[model samples]
Target: MKVDVQLLKDICEAPGAPGFENPVRKLIIEQIKDHVDEYSIDNMGNLIAIKKGTKNPDGKKVMVAAHMDEIGFLVSHIDDKGFIRFQTLGGFDPKTLTAQRVIIHGKEDVIGVMGSKPIHVMKPEERNKPSKIDEYFIDCGMSKEELEKKIEIGDPITRERELIEMGECVNCKSIDNRVSVYILIEALKNIKSPAFDFYGVFTVQEEVGIRGANVSAHSINPDFGIALDTTIAYDLPGAQAHEQVTALGAGTAVKIMDAMTICDSRMVKFLKKTADSHQIKWQPEILAAGGTDTSGVQRMGKNGSIAGAISIPTRHLHQVIEMAHKDDIVGSIELLIAALEEIDTASWEY
Candidate 1:
């Protein structure tokens, strides 16, 4: 069955920067309340929703996590010309900063455009050199005095890109984990099998670090964990075959290793077997850089528990135009449900 594109769009468009995820948290709670047995928000802003199984209450615990935070900017300084100087809350390519519009969240909403020195107005040496994020400023079309009336330091800023349909794929900002979040929600809605008690965690502050997951994992102490996230798809021109981590439209990605976590092999095999039995499309991923909440959950308690990740192949991650295939998302949800249904607690060790 097809997932609702409008729901995905709404989740992606919601503004939830690191350390500020109330808006997104509320949206998720509303969507999954009926499907879960219990739900609560931790002190660090992680939203945890539980789905109990028919088995014993002391049965195995399974946690599925997706982060709700997106990469954005924070107001650092405002200049005399009403220009806003900012510091990045996460990683950004300086090349992508020119001429982009941003929403500055102050006491009130303020729209601004990223401003940089035009090449025509720059020196010959400067024209050939690439720009740095520090060289950029946001113009809000107000005087310094007037700007103070609206915006202030520590205000959040987000990319001003709208979700759009391109051919068969959907593109928007924050699709990295939002798409994964949607997958988990859809899976929980359709699950009807006997399995361990499940916890769907929508974590915060992931773009800055896996801060929320670290705390949530400790609270749940799950016996098994799966982090739903997005992985890079370097399938564009000039990228080599080996460098292409995964490709869009191929299938859902099962990550073996990334920079932070080495996935549990038994859990990986179990997911793969379930996908095969259910005829779900899937791919294997080995990310060279970056990590996800899997790392935190894998080492939460004494010696921790089995942990792995199911990732969607995404193009232009951390950018305004992130892309993912519709079929891959469906496949991810199917695979997750199948695994949950077929997982044998007696076979697993610790």
Candidate 2:
């Protein structure tokens, strides 16, 4: 199956902070508006779509989720000298904020550069430790009057990096979960006849917390649930081999557990079986740190649903530039299709 390169670029490049997911949601809606049986945007900013099944007219409800939010900052305080101080919307590695370019979504979009004290002027003790995010300021190259006229407090800020194609990988901001959004949209377009009624939910606020998925899952209350997201690929230097979690190009990750929840063992087994039967590249994931929407979906309603996650191996997560391999991206969609095609025979009760 071929992945849509342009769509992937559009999703990754779109600005969608935790509570500001409209831009990304609009793009997703445009792509799958006609493909699904029905779809709607919830009050919590989730795009929930349903695709009916022909094989089992009375089958169970199967829910698939992918979050659309990206880590960013919100303008909190602006100094009289035109320096913009902001608060983080999601998790960030403070070290990565230095020297990065960002766009402030205010009355109008304004480009800004993160500024900090020059290293040459820093004290020996200061240079030894990493600078905190609060210590850095955004420079819009505008005077106090010009900045006050256009920008205001509470505006959202997003990374301004464009998607770049490496030899076999793609690098851009917000790859943490946009890659999965691409996967879900592509899988929905490709999977012609699923075995069970599918509720594909494009969620929000995943980076801040699994709030959107929690509300949507309680509302849908599906029998089976799956969270499509990206996992840490610490295959770079300085990371120990045993703690790599996952590797780039190692294939789609069958998440066993993460910092949030332990995936349903039955679902885990079924996914492995499907991947093997179809000869798809796969790996087991145990995220030592961090979580996903899988946690909220697994324990939503009365009896709860059997839940698991499919993760794309990613490098430099929560940074200005995150990376994912093309093979892993395509492999994730292939595995999702294969699993959905065999959902009837696959047991979820363990």
Candidate 3:
């Protein structure tokens, strides 16, 4: 599909914890500032960019949200032996933290290893039980005084990993929304003439809550919206087919509903029709749990928006090695661009 692997890699690897989105926001602005008609960063760190439409006489606006923040942690305490305790910023499974690497952002970037009780010491009952978040600590291999020189309290900590392609899929740490960020950037570059004024927003703190999207939507008050994010692809060795919400390498996903929002009926139909018309491969997404920035983009605006999402099928979501099919990634960009261009032709009337 001729995907830009390097660009996606850079975006995915950049560190941007919830409420600490500076690094990602800078990278996004560098990639998209000139491509859009106008761009600005809001107080909450959402990067809002716009491109004027060709045929919008009513000044309709379509807001596209792609959250830039990844689930991360904040340093809460540093012990006498240089071990660090942290408070989580987003949902994190404790099992994923054992033996994983993390980068603590203080005066300088300090690498630390996640440490927990050794399996050799665990009792039979404890051996099978899942670890809790409080059981983990960061080991920096330094003394209290030495670690204190380079570290500080409340610094953001992010998972350490690099993006790589594995046959037909790409795997990385922040593929959840960074992949969507890359899609939005590429969509902006490829869009020739949007049907309505395009408001592409790289939202911040979404990993914590829908803070950035909430504020941005209220200000833009868009008539229509499309959120770009990753959805769970549980197509593993499970025995049941219905349990697999989506599948890797299948295609892009058109939103029906998630734990947070039910996509507007018209928007859902429009996305399906657009994909069918363009021959863009797609699958239906009905996530049983977890939500995206769709909640804010759909309802936080003044009059609310006819909003839905174009989801990339992702595997191992929220873990260190999240994966997404290259074909689904490519198809998501195509579907988003097609949806933006053809939005005006849809019968939005309820």
Candidate 4:
């Protein structure tokens, strides 16, 4: 069965920066309420939804996590000319910050553009140097008095990009994780077989430091854990084959290691076997730079638990135009469902 592209689009386009995930949290709750057997929110805003197993209560508990927050900006100070100075909530490449449109969430929605000194007006020395984020400001086209009337010091700003389909792929902001969240939801909808009790967690504040996952893991203490997220695909120009990470259209990525955690080898092998037996497409991934919720869940319990990651290969992550193939997204959903269907306490070594 095909994944719902429109639903993925909706989730990616929603605004939910770290520490400000209420809107996206509500959207996810609305979508999964009818399908999940049980659901609730923890103190840290992690949304945990469960589908009970058909087997006896002795079955193992499996936790699947996907972060719901996106990289965005927080308003720092509004200058006299109504230009807004901001701080980034997550990692950002300063090279991508010029002339981009952003939505400043205030008393009312206000649209703005990132303003910088034009090349013609800059000194020759500045032309060769990359611009720092602090060097740019947002222009809302309002007077200083008018700006203070609506926006404040802590308002959030998100990239303004509508979801768009390009060939067989989809592109938009926040697909880095929102797409993975959609995959988890879709898999829950498609699974019909008996398996271990499953808890799908939509975690918050991951971009800030995996804060929600740390708390949620301690609460659940599952026997097995899997983090569904996106991995960078450097298959573009100037990228070498070894450094490509994972390629687009190469199927869902089964991560071996990232900066945060090294996946349990046994769990990795089990997932790979399950995918192969079920005819699900997959690729091996090793991310050199970043981490995910996997780290927190892996080391949370007494002696900890087995952990792994399933990733969608994405290009231009944390940007307004992140891209992922539809086929890879579908493959990830299928593989996740297959793994959950066959999960058992005996399969876990620890």
TM-score of 2: 0.98
How far in Å is the alpha carbon of 246 misplaced in model 4? 0.2
lDDT of 3 by residue, 29-140 (tens): 9999889999998988899999999989999999999999999999999987889999999898789889999999999999999999999999999999988999899998
lDDT by candidate, in order shown: 0.87, 0.91, 0.93, 0.89
Which parts of model 2 are misplaced by more than 4 Å? none
Whichever of 1 and 3 has more lDDT, that candidate is: 3
Candidate 3 structure lDDT: 0.93
lDDT of 1 at 182: 89
Per-residue lDDT, model 1, residue 228, is 93
How far residue 130's Cα lies from its native spot in candidate 2, in Å, is: 0.5
Give the Cα error of residue 264 in candidate 4, in Å. Answer: 0.3
Model 2, position 252: C-alpha lDDT score: 90
Q: Tell me model 2's lDDT, rounded to 2 decimals.
A: 0.91
| All candidates: TM-score | 0.96, 0.98, 0.99, 0.97
Ranking by lDDT: 3, 2, 4, 1
Candidate 1 segments whose C-alpha is farther than 4 A from its true place: 56-58
CA lDDT of 18 in candidate 3? 95
